[model samples]
Target: MRAITFVPGKQGTLGITDVPEPEPGAGDLLVQGLALGICGTDRELISGEYGWPREDPMILGHESLGRVLQVPEGSAYSPGDLVVGVVRRPDPEPCGACARGEFDMCRNGEYTERGIKERDGYGSERWTVEAAYAVKLDPGLGTLGVLVEPASVVAKAWEHIERIGSRAWFEPRTVLVTGAGPIGLLAALLAHQRGLEVHVLDRAADGLKPALVADLGATYHAASDLKAVGFKPDIILECTGAGPLVFDAMLNTAAAGIVCLAGVSSGGRLLSADAGQINRDIVLENDVVFGTVNANLRHYRAAADALSQADAAWLERLITRRLPLDRAPEAFDRGQDVKVVIELGE
Candidate 1:
């Protein structure tokens, strides 16, 4: 089978190569790979900036969509079902969080993730996943189901946001989503689904991004400064790891507001921030700033539900480009696209 492989920490090692076909163990599902979504994490892995160091090249895709080719008897899924494999698996020690099926919040940082960490990912012509970790999607989703994985991340973020907001009388009416990328757009989608007034901020002054946000019945601001957003947002989903923008979001939210940090920032850059004022604002306003990454089964399921209920046309627009497996490496090139997907099947 042809698969996208990369040697972790080795720059210029990403390519298409032949690998043994996946063999499913008991209680596993053999799936025919359909599509693979490319994100910043994939680019980091290809650039040798992130991922566990391994001598041999490992398959390199986590955002996956496929149709089940075979399933164990009595499995909840069946052959021909559309499914997406969960990325993170429980750690060996199974930390308190992982033991509770919250490996996304692995306390010891020992958890293994498919297509990441020490395990082989699903960026192949075919793949196998334990039935428990395979999320069955609506057949109607087709290739768009590749979005479940990223959506799951924001689902977990919203889940945590609500949990924190529950401490007070939380009826948030306005939300500001920083960055108009996949995560930010999906974050806005989920917020819109909840009936919140959504506003998205990005650097692009004119592009499909601003148009997409407008189609959602939400407002879009194409400005680097958050001050242009005008009113203080009741909730802020900061999807751009830009240092200055992150701090701007912290101080720009309404009183008792919650800010969800869902973007991973590349280090080595320093900024002079007013720590005292930032701390004072949070303490005085009782605001919360939290970071979330990855997703467990619960979030994946929530993501599937959200995708299923979303406007199909809108969801389709998120995928701006699709390439064949042989051209998978090209998908990593940064472009003015919301999502880039690699088609694994002919």
Candidate 2:
């Protein structure tokens, strides 16, 4: 099968090449790739920063939407079903935390997280995986629901925000989302659905225009001047992964407000979030700070539900560009791309 892969044996180089198709293991589902997304992590994996197997051929794509080509006869999902799966392929332990229905804490695990390890990924003509990892989308949901995985990531933050928040669903309050990256825009969209007065901040106004068109969130701003304007919010989610800005949001959140840190750094640089600063600025201020990672299965369901409820107009905004696998590199080049989908075998 043809794929764009990172072929570094150790501390090494990046390139695209052909590779063998995957063999779905026990409880596995074989899926044909329909569309895949290029994520920042993929870029880092290319540079060998995200810890790709130092001595193996690494397949790097984790975001995708597709259809089941085959599965065991009684696999609980039908072949030809539309699906979207997560980035993580966790280890299995039936008697452990996940089997007790606690998937997030599952221990004895193997991450067949393709494009990052020995496992082949979805950025190819075909992919095979554990049927348990597959998530079937309702036929009623369509293409946008096909995007449920990433969107659910945003929804998870909202679920957490709503949980920690004192504001009732009936009461309207503002939320300030910093950064207009895909994650940030998605956060804004979720906040909009919750009926919060939403403010989106982004330096590239054009970059945020699509989000504006969806009316996913109202008001865009230069990334600069966020602090000077006093756009205090009951909740703020820092999706840019800029630690300094995270601290800014922490300081600015209204009393009893919540903040979610949703981004991952690429350059491998560290920032200081002083303990005294946390005690004096956030804790003393009675703010909630949550460092959230990937969502569990429930967030996936909620994200699907939200996608199902959303209008067609919104999905169109999210799918900014659809490129063939060969053109995938351009998707990562900086400037003028919100979310780029690689249409596999198109």
Candidate 3:
């Protein structure tokens, strides 16, 4: 078997090498990946900025689709079943936030990221996972199965948006997605399906060109003058890691509007913001800003179903490129598309 392994050493030295194949035992499973998606976190992990607490050689793929080659009996999973699942788990002495099912805030961070901490990752010829932790994907769904994990994050955030605005969530209002990247585009796609007029704001033209060509039912704008457009978004989903976008999005939201933070920054550098701006200009100004992270399996279900009604007209136009696993590093470095899927074993 072959897998991408990261050892304790200088970053970028992680490599694919032959490894022992895994077999299902106890409550575990063996999966054969069809397609896996890479996110910005992979870069952070390779660079050791994501704080994975891992020093030994470890496998590195997370967002992936695989068939259950073997599974413990009586588990929801079965051999030959397709599935998608997260690597995070609840810590026994987890913080209040995580005890309530928020795995991101678990006090014991090591217990929070399973694939990175304890288990092997998906970027391998064979992968093993706790059968109870996986979500069974209907094989009939095809490649869309690989999208469940990422799209689920958007679905969870949407649940938050609906709660904040109630009936006004989609009433002829504008919405802005700060980055226009894959996550940003997923949010745009979701917002568009809910009948809200969506627009994307980005500083770069590299990825937006394909989005425009796809007619994703979205309008694109430069981030510099969002207010000049004279339409304040009722809700903003900030996918840009830059802090200025959050400040600007708060400033440009309508009364009772909400801003959800979807980007992750690992440097621990705080973004400067006006103490009074969020209080006076946002809260006092009636704008709400919140942060979001990974999703549990429920969101995965919604994301898979979203593909059915989401402008199927845009599918081919939306897939920028599909590259083999060996080229995953180059794709991350170049960031050449809206959504890049890593082709795994056929």
| Model 3 CA deviation exceeding 4 Å by range | 94-110, 166-172, 206-214, 266-273, 311-313
Ranking by TM-score: 1, 3, 2
Q: Give the RMSD in angstroms, all C-alphas superposed, for model 2.
A: 3.3
Question: Per-residue error at 42 for model 3, in Å?
Answer: 0.2
Candidate 1 displacement at residue 254 in angstroms = 0.9
> Pairing residues by index, what is the TM-score of model 3?
0.87
The numbered model that scores best in TM-score is 1
Give the alpha-carbon lDDT of every model: 0.94, 0.70, 0.73
Ranking by lDDT: 1, 3, 2
User: On lDDT, who's better, 1 or 2?
Assistant: 1
Model 1 C-alpha lDDT per residue in residues 36-82, reported as the tens digit of each score: 99999999988999988989999999999999999999988889999
Cα lDDT of model 3 by residue, 1-346, tens digit: 7777775333875677777887767998888877877777776677766544546777777787888888777877768898876767777677676677667546656465544555567877778778767878666667767777778889889987887767454453778888777788788889888888888877765454535624876788764546644688778898876766767777888788888999875455777777675678775656678888777666767787786566554654455778776775565665556667777778
lDDT score at residue 117, model 3, on the 0-100 scale: 55
Q: Write the per-residue lDDT of candidate 2 for residues 188-226, one digit (tens) a residue.
A: 877888877888776664644544634764666665536
Structural similarity to truth (TM-score) of each candidate: 0.99, 0.86, 0.87
Model 3: how far residue 3 lies from native, Å? 0.5
CA error at residue 249 for candidate 3, angstroms: 0.9
